[model samples]
Target: MAIKIYGSFRSPFVMAVALAVYEKEQEFELLMMNIKSPEYMNNFNPFGKIPSYQDEDITLFESRAIMRYVATKFEGQGAPLLGSTFSEQALCNQWLEVNGHSFTPAIVEMAFSKADTESSKLAFEKFEKVLDVYEARLSVSKYLAGDSYTLADLAHTPLFHIFMAVSDDEKKKCLTSRPHLHAWIQDISSRPAWKKVTERPENTFYKPRTESQ
Candidate 1:
């Protein structure tokens, strides 16, 4: 079978994985399963989470793992998913860990807090601190991994897209507050492939809400 991706567009993690596939000039079928359902839990990912990838060679779960798989498999076809230099590659891994273990959680909490009576203020405060680190690093480098955009930078694209769309106020938070980070965000967000990915008819994720975003 063709590469089959299991998950909904509702997840930024899922969207990032999809973006990685597209960046590699490949297509995949988007399959959303009720993660808690027996079939999904048992046959796909026993952990009952979204975003599993399958093809003739093997099956995979976790967005980062899936992205890595695509990067390794299609290395010759598209954007250098992994960095060219050893140091850049190491930074790529470090930043991806930040995307997973640090930055995304606070930012996601800030997003989900919109749906419930949660501590959005605290989340925002925490997110700002994270952004501060990004601003510092970006002031020195053009992309997260180095001079060229890598998987680490691509991983956060969907996130910054949503953050830009929540509201004008939120969008400004992404730009007006952090000059270096904002510039890097704007640069990466301007990719033609990213525009195409968002415009895909099958997309069911959050829509852009800003006039310029």
Candidate 2:
């Protein structure tokens, strides 16, 4: 059976999973549903999350897990996303954890929150700290897990896209001021797989915000 991903591209998590599938040189059907519907809750994600994945061998929820599965299942086909060496693999998992638990929370807050409020200010402060960690790591390495572009690098593409789209100049500087981090962002976002993901029709929801808007 063809793989089916139950979600919308508006969700970065969904986009990340889709990017992973593309990186593995596989195609999937993007399906949508009322996530709160009983069928979705029961069969897809009980939590009613946007991205749930299904393939011939399994049904899964959670975008990161789905990405891992796709990377491993099709490991030989496309870009080697899981890392080429034991140290690289270990570092890949480590950075992926940081991306999920630390970086995502800070950036998501800053991206969606109204600027200039005390809360937004605090969020930016936190996000900069997270960016600093990335900058430091990236200063010495071309990719997050090393020279190889792994899932650690892939996971951040959609999040950074949304961040850059919505962030004001000050907030944007947290990323841009760091030369290495900015360059790394450019590198990862430039991949053919990520380009394909962004060019998809379902990607309409997160267009870059204009000043007039």
Candidate 3:
């Protein structure tokens, strides 16, 4: 059976999972579900989340978990997303945690809040600190988990895409100011799999905007 991903590209979680599938050289059916419907709740995700994964073997929720499963299940097929070495694997997991606990919150706040507002200022402060951390780490390493691209880096791509789409030049200075971090974003965002994701019709809604636009 073809893998079915329940949600739309509007949800970064859904896009992340789709990117993982593509990284593994797999195809999936993008789908929508009435998340609150009993059929969806019982069969897909009890919590009624936007992205739920269904394959021949199992059905799963939680985007990170789905990405991990895809990376592991399709290992050796395409890009080796789950780190090739034990150390890389450990670091991959560590950075994945950082994406969840530290990075996501700050980026979410920055993306959604009104510019120049008190909340936006606080978010920028927090986000800049996090970007500083990334800049330092990426300065030394080519990729988050080492030289090889891993789920750690993949997890961050969609959020950055959305940030770029909605942010103005002044706001984007947070990302573009950090040389290494900016380079890393460019590298990841340039991947062919991500290109396909962005080119999909569903992604039209989040098309990146420049200050002049």
Q: Give me the candidate number with maximum TM-score.
A: 3
TM-score computed on alpha carbons, candidate 3:
0.96
lDDT of 3: 0.92
| lDDT scores in order | 0.84, 0.89, 0.92
lDDT of 3 by residue, 85-191 (tens): 99999999999999999999888877788877999888889899999999999999999999999999999999999988887887788889899999999999999
Clashing pairs in 2: none
TM-score per candidate = 0.92, 0.95, 0.96
Displacement of the residue 142 alpha carbon in candidate 3, Å: 0.6
Task: Please report, as a residue range, the 10-residue window in candidate 1 with the lowest summed lDDT.
Answer: 167-176
87: Cα error in model 2, Å: 0.6
lDDT value, residue 50 of candidate 3 = 82
Off by over 4 Å in 3: 210-213
lDDT of 2 at 192: 95
Which lDDT tens digits does candidate 2 get at residues 98-200?
9889989888887777867999888878888888899889989999999899999999999998877876776577777899999988889889999999899
Question: Which lDDT value does model 2 have at 181?
Answer: 94
TM-score, model 2 to reference: 0.95
